[model samples]
Target: MEPPRDAKLLDPTTQPARIRAMYTDPDFVRRGLGRAILARCEGAARAAGFRSVEMMATLAGEPLYQACGYAAIAPVRSAPVEGVTVPLIRMGKWL
Candidate 1:
């Protein structure tokens, strides 16, 4: 499924590598599944010697990511989702 509005803040120029899209089903969002998936992804990146990972975040997800230690790399920006506009923030964490 396509991300919602506010899901477009990912700037390829600012990313360590091209950002890959990821998401958790809404029903599983509060069950720690998102964190688990992020942990696994980070672990694999770390094992591969990657120093960091990055993502563009929706307003709904920013807090959860922050709780996991991801921090903003830049101010929030406006992103278009479908034909709608939404706020987005660029975030990253060293692995």
Candidate 2:
């Protein structure tokens, strides 16, 4: 996956790695793929010197994140897209 937006401009030792996106095939849901991927992401972030990881998670994804030990930071609304908006939760975990 691509590095988080503007990653080069941020200091890994001070800034959290942004988990820009994550997905699993519907047929593979609940089969541990998400958890595995998340673990890998955290490992990569930690290895890169990031102190934490964060993301704006859709409601459908919030449960999985929560189950994996991420804490909800706040509720946020995505910027309008062609007059539509999405509800999301900001969540993070220390690595």
Candidate 3:
């Protein structure tokens, strides 16, 4: 069974595969699942011949990605979703 926290498969692209989404249940936060899932994504990307893994990190999630060795590529940007614009940071990790 999947853990309460989960990561989506990377999106195929000409550049690095992008982590489509990742979420951890609030009740299960800070239990290392996020880091584990991130590692799995990187491992998968590397196995697939990708040189890097990228993602758009939610404002709240940015710190977690950063702590896992992802480097920021640009300043934060806004994306409108569900009638509100949320800040997201572009981050990538070399595989």
Per-residue lDDT value at 89 in model 3: 82
Considering lDDT, which of the candidate structures 1 and 2 is the better prediction for this target?
A: 2
12, model 1: CA deviation in Å? 15
Over 4 Å off, model 1: 1-19, 76-82
lDDT of each: 0.74, 0.90, 0.81
Q: Which ten residues in a row have the lowest lDDT in candidate 3?
A: 1-10
TM per candidate comes to 0.70, 0.88, 0.78
Is candidate 2 or 3 superior in TM-score?
2
On the 0 to 100 scale, the lDDT of residue 34 in model 1 is 81
* lDDT of predicted model 2: 0.90
Q: Compared with the true structure, what per-residue lDDT tens digits does model 1 show for residues 2-91? A: 555564554433445323566878877789988887888788766656677888888788888899999987757665556777777889
Worst 10 residues of 1 by lDDT: 10-19
**Tens-digit lDDT track of model 2 for 1-95:** 33345535557977788887799999999899999999999999888889999999999999999999999999999878778889999999988
Clashing pairs in 2: none
Q: Given candidate 3, what's the lDDT at residue 5?
A: 40
lDDT value, residue 9 of candidate 3: 50
| Segments in model 3 whose C-alpha atoms lie over 4 Å from true places | 1-14, 76-78
Screening candidate 3 with a backbone cut-off below 3 angstroms (N, C-alpha, C), the clashing residue pairs are none
